[model samples]
Target: MMRNLMRIEIYDTTLRDGTQAENFNISVDDKLRIAQELDTLGVDFIEGGWPGSNPVTIEFFNRIGEIDLKHSKIVAFGSTRHIKNRPEEDANLQALLAAKTPAIIIFGKSWDIHATDALNISLEENLQIIEDSLAYLRPHVEHLFYDAEHFFDGFKNNEEYALKTVASAIAGGAERIVLCDTNGGTLPHEIPPIIKRVKEFVAGLSETVGLGIHPHNDSDSAVANALMAASSGVEQIQGTMNGFGERCGNANLTSIIPALVFKMGFDCGVKEHISRLYGCSRLVTELANLPHNHYQPYVGKSAFAHKGGIHVSAVKRNPLTYEHIAPELVGNSRRILLSDQAGRANILFKAKEWGIHIRPDDPILPAIIKELKELENLGYQYEAAEASFELIMRKLLGLRRNYFSFQGFRVTDNKYRMDKPPLTEATIRLSVGGVEVHTAAGGDGPVNALDSAIRKALIRFYPILEEMELVDFKVRVLSGEYGTEAKVRVLIESRDGEESWGTVGVSVNIIEASWQALIDSITYKLMKEEKK
Candidate 1:
């Protein structure tokens, strides 16, 4: 028997729900950039924000409409007509139509709580809200999607009434009906029969009017819910890029789409443009100026990173044995995290990445690894802080890189000439590759002055740091210590050319801790560049 392909439609709502996350705000320029990216990612639909919700979103959809989106259909999203206004007369509906996009999505309350509290409408009135709005948009657009907000819990609590609401929208000519897990509490197992009953309850309409699933991740079940719905023959799936939303966030289309196309064997046209997904994911995070989650499933920093000796050894032999998928398949690079847990094979890979070669039987490989472990046991962690790890490798190689190093440094903790002035004066005497050099700098504290002095000295040799800024610097006292005098570790994150790298250091003195991190930061960048 010849096999039939399962083709599913993907609707991306990153610009809308993604912006709803706390502390995230995207500019119109950023919105346009995301639109262009999603377009290139080959999504079936790109839901720009509601046209009448705000001027920024309105202008964004309009501006984006002018740009040609090759394979994606631009969609305008909004709520149903106002309680008192007619759908034809409502300004929001008219604004959605004015957006000039090909499709429109309108959301309405399906739960009794939202109906009574949020919408302040009786059950009958809310059903009309969904029906009338869909009927009004049907004449203007070919694809009109209706979102039954909180549909699952609504169905579970009051099955008859919830299905009645969906029936109303479908009867009013909604091309696709999407059941939303607004609270994201529904389970994967529960979804199969729920979708089956809903499809069966609708009778002959399932084929004429397609089914869709839009889930949130409050219970971290958005992906599972969407996956289960697809198994039940849902034709469309809606979600945001990185699960960014109001509370626990919308489903991460970044994750769901990959699993659907790659694992589930759904012919979503997703693999044809898989390379753009990584860049798109990073672009949205950068536009929001947020730190991308390092463990974010497939695209995260440590997604493909291997650190343990046995695992690293197996991965080198054949990555597919341990890795579910090749990272390059999704435009991501494989990173082997280096820490005390690493073995000789791990060191070999790291050295190879840095353009050095070391045999597995080399005495220094095991000895240096042991030394690194001893340092870590003394509370130095090189996982998040890779710069210090690089320095350890370089020192063990006895390869004196043609670069500068600190010769001497001193700190004076006292009140300055002004009693209110910052209370630290740090003096430093350092050299670049053993060339005698000295400098003293001022800062609010010793750590600040020490870092400033190091960067200032290095500017004379490798001045690229003038533009490369330290985006964030963090420190932690290992939980084992109870006294004030206990040693602490520091993690420094530095960014250059839109790329960032992390490194670590440890010391008893806070200043010493910060200095170790500072030195590692400079060395890692220099060494990383020299290889390139």
Candidate 2:
């Protein structure tokens, strides 16, 4: 007997439903860029925003035609005709046609309460609008899809009425009828049986129509429900990148695509480009200006990271012993995190990565691990400050060269007027190649003044320091018992046009902590330049 294999459709709504998330807003150009990325990733459909909603979405539809998409079809999303207006006179329906997309998807009320309470229309009239709206757009578009909004809830409350609405969609002319878990309350176990009944109902009407699923992540089961629907024979799966959507989120296509391709053996258009999954997920988060979830499956920084001694040793021998899939399959790499829990295996791995030579029985290896543990106990973290850790290793091996020496620094904050801000000034004395230099500068804050003073003192000696810039600075208090006098940790991120590096320091005084991190940052930049 031949095995059953399904060709699943990958429909992405990141530009539409994804924007409904709070603080997740993008401009028209951002949407175009994301759409192009989705097209390049080989998604089957890219649902553009509702053309009737706002001027930005309207401009998107108008301008999107300029880009040539290779693998994806542009889809315009909207709602069914209003009960008060005819199908031809409805503004929402008219805008969908005006968008000129090859595919269109419109949603209608399926739950009885939504029709009676939300729409303020009888259940029978609600069915009429669903049929008439799709019937009107069916002849105009190459592919027409109907979304039975709140479909799972509708089936649970009034199964008969929900089926009536679905029947009306088939009576009209929908190529695909997508059942939606709009409120996202439905669990995974509830999906297959409900879809089975719908399949039977559709079979009774016509055998040509296909089924699709749109699930949200309110219950954190959106991906599970979508997978269940696919196993139960739904032809299309609708979701967004990184699970971004209204309320909690939509189904995460990043996780679902790999599951379908590798675990379930389903064919999808994006299967050939699956290695771009991590980059695609990260690009969406970067464009949104949101922090990436390091714990997110398949694409997060910590997803494939090994920290424990036993785990690292096992993985170094055979990755399948600890990992579910190869991280490279999804454009991600394995990370060996350095911490108090790390052992000799972790040290050797990082040594090789940094091109530092050390044997498995080298005497300096144990010393490095001991110093690392002591620093971590003092609240020093090397995970984000690999430059500091690398410097430590090079110094232990007598391979590091000192570019400059720090003598002393002074910072003062003075406020003269009540309404005006305080004036901060920093003075630094340092020596480069046995030559002494002293400088002073004013800035918006104490750290800024100190940074300015140090740069002023060093730039003339090491002209390359002019290209180095501080990109980000973060501080964390290690203890709260002393409150204002607590020990603090500072992390400084610096970039010099080619790459960025992080350095860290810990001290009881915030300025001292910042100064330590600043020195490490400069040292790392100088070392990188010397290597180049």
Candidate 3:
């Protein structure tokens, strides 16, 4: 298929629209950091936020000016002037001007129902507000955009009135008129015809103005809709990073960018820096304190993972047979998952990755695969806990050295008073370099106490262990049939200055499971140091 060769502007609303997502909150500093990263990624426009809405947003506008951006134009977003106040007198417009951004965007009611019911105003008066607001700010800003809120629905309900709103925005000097899928109800098939009519309407009125699409993901088709709109001749795409927004989310630019460049053959400012797409996606989620969706498209961990024996074999011989594009194109690497379904190809691929040489015909290869399947049957998931799997592989090959021997450990939690919190303490003994070391420590909980005690026992012998810290801990109950007696699985994520790795442990006793994970985490750190 011939790809669409057009220049499409990339507009990112991650700092503004993305913050509306539940539990996806970030500080002003975080917004600044994200803005810098977006600029580095070469987005054409970064919608800072609704500057008039909150103090944090106002502060963001104030602080963003200090950092000199190289590519993206910082945009301040707001609504049209109020009914009671003139355009210059409206506080929202005033806030946008105060932001002193190179570009400004103001959304106005396009659906006649919103003007009548939501704004409690006549349809004609709404048109006046939309036009006057843009006219007032026309000379002050270098670039001006008018977002016709709910344009798709409004066009469906009252086509004449919706076109009238677009006419108002054009009359007031909007450089770009963006049709918004505010409720995200528009389908991909529904996009082209509407956009075709709107493009005709705009061409009839003015030749210099352009059209843009701002789509939400309520129908899980925002990306599709945006692509369809582009195919239908829209010049710009507006979306948030990782699809973070109110309700479902805005269209995800992370998925949209690569698709546009690699699949659709569109050119944009970020095309040269597209390899940063995966890292940029991870940074946004990390700063928001949210776990990266392993199954997400393009940038997900499992996007290029091969598991089935035939699939792995085929991928090892030729990736294009089973893969769409090179994972490295988006800064992601292929993962050969070592599950029960995985075969020799997966094991050999992993061995090469870890610098462990093993012959394809080695007699021990089948034994290693058998032991891996047995451990998985016993509920050991090696996919997420790769460090533990690596240790097992080394031990089976007789290549692993014993850095420490586990002696014993005890934990106690006592509550002296009803009004006070419980006291938790742990004592641990270990033999390192044939020297026995015993220590005790207290913590906020049993697992924490145990972690502290182990660190105390080992830090003196291996000072490098001090650089390692548990960044994340997750516990999952395997089943509910046995209720409290059911087995629990603990996954711990540890990181030093250089890198991070995951380790997993499972047992009926939660503490024992945690201990097993902790032991693996420490051992992995030591193993890495010894290899270096």
Best by TM-score: 3
* Per-prediction TM-score to the true structure, in the order listed: 0.92, 0.97, 0.98
lDDT of 3 by residue, 70-91 (tens): 9999999999988999877889
Question: lDDT tens string, model 2, 1-532?
Answer: 1233779999999999999988998889889989999888889999999996999899999999989999999999999999999999999999999999999999999999999999999999999999999999999999899999999999999999999999999988998999999999999999999999999999999989999999999999999999999899999999999999999999999999888887788989998999989999998998888888899999999999999988999999999999999999888999998889989999999989988999999999999999999999999999888899999989999988998989999999999899999999999999999999998999988988999999899898789999999988999999654888789999999998898899999999899999999999998888888887
Model 3 has a clash total of: 0
User: Which runs of model 2 end up more than 4 angstroms from their true locations?
Assistant: 1-4
Pick out the ten consecutive residues of candidate 2 with the lowest summed lDDT: 1-10
Each model's Cα RMSD? 2.7, 1.8, 1.2
Question: Which of the two, 2 or 3, has more TM-score?
Answer: 3
- Pairs with steric clashes in candidate 1: 385-503, 385-504, 404-432, 404-433, 407-430, 408-429
lDDT of each: 0.84, 0.93, 0.93
Angstrom error at residue 448, model 2: 2.8
Ranking the candidates on TM-score from highest down gives 3, 2, 1
Where does model 1 exceed 4 Å of error?
Answer: 1-4, 112-120, 412-425, 432-435, 464-467, 528-532
TM-score, structure 3 vs. true = 0.98
